[model samples]
Target: MVAKMAACTGSKDGQDSILEPLCFPEQPASSTSAPSLQGPSVELLVCLFCPESVPLRQKDVLLKHLLLDHKLVIGDVRLIADLPKYMLYWRGRFLEQPVSDFCSVIKTNSTGPLEKQEDYFLLCDVLPEDRILRERLQQKRLEEVLEQQQLERDDSSFHRLCMFCSEEFTGNRSSLLNHMAREHSFSIGLPDNIVYCKQFLDTLQDKLDNLQCLYCEKTFRDKTTLKDHMRKKAHRRINASNREYDRFYVINYLELGKTWEEVQSEDDRELADDEDDDWSDWWAHPVSAVCLFCDHQSETMEQIYSHMKETHGFDLHQLRTELNLRFYQQVKLVNFIRRQIHQSRCYGCQETFECRDDVLRHLVAEGHVMTLPDASTWNQPQYYFPTYENDALLCTLSDSDEGENGETSHVEDVPVIAEDVSELRALKQSSVLNQLLKSRGCSS
Candidate 1:
């Protein structure tokens, strides 16, 4: 469906047209051809090998080191039939995950323990192009062997002349010629040692040039040999070693001093009340010289020791031993004061109450009427309630009886009942007095 959409397009006339025909009916389903993909020139072909030199029994130790140290991913693996008992790391971690995605099973450069080197080298020797290169090299060597045999059998006079110098030579003419051409400047016929050796070395050096290093034209024979040299500590030391050491030491020293300066600056800020303008606050002492716990200061000596014992539960000897402090006599003292304050109670009943409501309840429950202290008769504490009536008073008495009988009142809470109870109680009280007058034959 995607292919069809990709292939279909619109022409200028606004009609749909086939931009490209999708591959379908003609193509075989069983085609094993690899899909074309754009990739890097040097593909990262990973390989991992765990040597027996390590103390650990598991190969995961070495695989973990590869990921942690070298930053490589192990893509896929095929078990070596001869050594199927060994453990393998499928990816970045220890895993038994299926690994069919990789081009091949690969082992990385893990070579040590003298016996492992040959096997490791053999594995490296088997690169994807290695077989073809080896065959070509073998054929070339065979041709050289045949040519050498023919030269040995030849009795021709041309054998007496050097191949390189063209000078007369009797025995082993080819060797003498190679010696002259490779080592000494003997002939200018084709190429001399000075010109060709310099050029050849230059070409070899160019082939081995790395991003950070240049191979020495005078030292190594070829690029591979130069690479071997590059792996050595001496060669690295010769190339940008100063820069590496300087970079590492500079980073370490800077990190060390950075923490020191940070701590010092934090202490300075804390002492100065975290304010840049308050420099004097760093040195200023508190107004009171008395210590909070012992109530002692720098002023008193003998009384300070006594205060330490009574207030802080610390004798001079105990304080000195446990707290690692100097003489308590060196300390000063301030007064430690303690006192109590009494609150007022109800005047008539002498009952402790925080507010007016409790005093009013006391008076009402006792069947006593309340009036101001200046009134002719002072029976109870008085409160101003303009809405109070006899009918409200009787209703309150009925609600109180219901409460004493363990019934839930229609009123929800204290605030609502408190607001309406005073008026209801007053109304109930007046109604009772009127009924008493009617029963006594008095006028309404």
Candidate 2:
């Protein structure tokens, strides 16, 4: 257990009166309790307004005193880089000057009928001094973390055994961590993603020795019982609400006021919102492409190609080879033919017809399937976008960059998750997954 410190009731001023003492422990101690995992050690937190008040263990207790007695409320305590040092600096400053000099005061019941009024001080980074203090603390912390990261990366004397099996690992801490995850299915996270490897491992080892569940934090009778409970209940993961593990992750140190989970969750929320977005304005339409020779519409490019070859004796693919048409060139030719047919005109002989059917009859009767007006007549840039918005033919147009077997060569799309036809991967065999599957009636 962490050794509790003796409270300093000794006043800094000339006052002779003694006060009650408060005590706490410095971390990296031998403890079986939850506080041992709270990576950093914060010991003496002095009251801001109380000169004779002893140092407090928890910052919340000191904040309570300030809020209740001094009417001082600190805004966004989580945003403070270093709370102990921050409070100490403010404590000294409060002694020299009034809090109103650096704080914004709100008088309660300003416009109310009540005669009595009370004031509350908001101590945020709104003041220039506080903003500078927070920024300086953040810079100092970043430098220290970077230095520590270099030391950890270079560390090689690490030696530990697997948490589940008795396999001993040397050279780097990741070896042991990876072994525990692979063999025991206990993954805290990726090795490269975290810092303070030694202390984090120690905290987990302490919990295991104490026969505690990592998730629920419940004490068990024995190691066997604890392991069984964790496996059966799917409690192999660390507690989500436990702020103690914050220091172990490098992401917690990267952002000013956000953790890795918070950053990751923001991305997840955006994707979820995108999935939930309203697409009610969209209406379903036929997936049909129009024929180049006539007004005949087919659901697919293949069907249209077949109909043109049979009815008009026009093999567009053959003509494409004869003219040595590139991908965009083929697109423009098809679009030009379609436009001419729609306007009741023959594109090959440049003859106007009474209707679309008359133009198709004229092209076939005059044997103008292989004939054209000119290269410049059909190879315009305006045919880049298909004339018909629902044209499936444009999607299947072959390109030199699309390999020998281009988009015209169809391949069915398959899902990433393969069906239960063979053996399952190692992840699917995990106890946690098995428990979840069993709960959902997917496993017997």
Candidate 3:
């Protein structure tokens, strides 16, 4: 409970009026409700914002006023650090002046200087500041009241069923016993066990009747162990009839109106959706890596290793060996393509086949179409031979060799056209994978 204080209006005199009066409810003087803000009884010097003649009592009230009103910016008001040098009196008189001492007494109870405490403490050194003290006490009382209100809100009394199924401790006991016997099929006989015969018999009878599962017939000393049996699969399979008996979940029919089936169905649906997202990251890569595979730049061996392991069936070791071999192979093929493009000549159209073809099969398969001039002279639209494009002898002998020796001439004629150029272009434009490689800054 925070104490309430009236606004401070300035005094007519040139001095600052620091304190304000407060109104509090009349209570027994013995009540321990005032905020404990007693300072040392010693007459220590305090800083004042008025002439040196201003009374010390006024300074104490001013500190309390500043703390309650400007607590956010100025914390504990006792030690004057960056406080304003003007004072407004209760009668609304305003005076401005530098405090003569520029220092205040260090209260005995406080561990450090007043400035360090959070803005809640309204410190005032003057012993006679009764009006401000009363307000602080009232505020403390208010806080206690608020705390008690919060505790009242937290206490909830809903359906309170006894752990033993024999008796339902609802608002009515007779109806509970009748419902237990008729609907639950509970027995009436009590048991004979232990020294406290009547008390133990009553307790045992309640447990045996209330226990939804008779197959286990296990009477736990505590409710927690009995609940574990209901949840475990072994108990569920044995006491299948007890599936409908949930003590914690049962709600009063007069208050809630919710059925057990509705709550169970909602819980099962959420469990199924959570299972699919566990595998979402297995096949999908980050969107940024898509461009790297689209263009066939020579991929680093490490990059290819990761790509093959993730996208293809290959793992790290096999991918590493394959990638290293592929890199050098592509490099050699690109160089060969450059040389063939420079040396090749065309015999059919009398034009260089440097980077051209009558009609390339793979190129057409990739959506490129070209009309072949003559099938006999062109030899089934062969790949553009960079070397044979300018070599007339190589082009002339290429077709004739196939006719003369068939398989032998066909093998020998292969060198007349360089196929490595196409392979080089394919490797250059189709394979580089850009992945965030872990920096190898540390060694094992």
Candidate 4:
């Protein structure tokens, strides 16, 4: 079949045609079943109360005029489908009855001490007629959008020359839409996802012909200036806030009684709401801290220490008291013991066994629990790390400055043991570890 004008308009004679209006060959509309975006619709929103007000193609302009001048506010004007028609219906009804009958009056804006407070009218779905009108318009808009979608989907007479280049496309609306998107970087959306293809293009072409920027709507002196402004400003698309163009996209009409934006955000809203309902109290449970030497595990650090002291005869409290271990020293000592036991070696004598049970038996039978290797051997810099990933025993290690009455001690994140390393004599004589280091020398 020969291509006809739908998306783009030109008498394509196999050459680069100028962007101009072309005729669409007549096709059966099935009048009772389909609605078209052709002919005059209510494109301009007129003030509902004003008799001689300027016609506003922009909804925002019309909305502001109504609020400031007429003291009327239309609720969620963006969400309202067929905004002009909705306003027109109310304009006619305002003449028939008192405006206060269908609207809620809010008295505000006191200009002076002598002047009376002005009353502002809120026209929303609180009234039954307003609710029914919104629902009816939404239902009508959805039906028309759906029918237009089917027409474009089955349309075969799509022919047009590129607005930016000399490329020509014939048959399948997507071919022209895709080419424009791929070559010129102009995309309204996927061809199948849009309705009213002809009207959408015509609206853009009219703006280009008038030398107006599609995004900013500023009029330029010439087509060259307009082209430069659009390209430089990255304005290759229509104005998003202009609700007049909402009828072209199928997404805006996909849902009833809700905006497309509201529907899309439901998942995010649900996740946020779920986070507020936390069950931290019910889900709380104690994670066990493992013993330093053996496989003995307890729920708390205190319980683990008690079990190790009673069962394995490994008194860590006695060692800390004798050595006057600081916060980091205790951390290193627990890690050192843990590393040695994991390698199936006794921390006391440094003797390797086939398994952990064999090492535990050797340590117990040989009475090497209190007999530790030289301080120089185990007190290397590498022992600062926790050998176990979530070493629970390290959590109970207190600072040397902590009082015997269970008072908390001041300590920084980094260990302060090396802070007084300059005073070698005092460190060597005061702590049992330094004394052991001197006595044992290099022997383990």
The better-scoring model by lDDT among 2 and 4 is: 4
| Model 4 regions lying over 4 Å from their true place | 1-32, 39-71, 109-115, 182-186, 205-245, 256-263, 266-444
- Candidate 3 lDDT over 59-130, as tens digits, reads 555454444553412223432311232222211221232221222333333676767644232223342332
RMSD, model 4, all Cα superposed?
A: 24.4
TM-scores of the models, in the order given: 0.13, 0.51, 0.12, 0.44
Ranking by TM-score: 2, 4, 1, 3
The C-alpha stretches of model 3 lying farther than 4 A from their native spots are 1-127, 130-140, 143-444
For TM-score, candidate 1 versus 2, the one ahead is: 2
Q: How far is candidate 3 from the true structure (C-alpha RMSD, Å)?
A: 36.9
User: Which candidate ranks first by lDDT, i.e. highest?
Assistant: 4
- Worst 10-residue stretch by lDDT in candidate 2? 16-25
| lDDT to native, each model | 0.31, 0.70, 0.32, 0.72
- Pitting candidate 3 against candidate 4, the one with the higher TM-score is 4
| Candidate 2 regions with alpha-carbon error over 4 angstroms | 1-39, 52-57, 112-115, 267-444
lDDT of 1 by residue, 97-160 (tens): 3232322343444366655432111221244443343344445433433333333323233234
The TM-score between candidate 2 and the true structure equals 0.51
Candidate 1 residues lying further than 4 Å off, grouped into runs, are 1-103, 106-140, 152-444
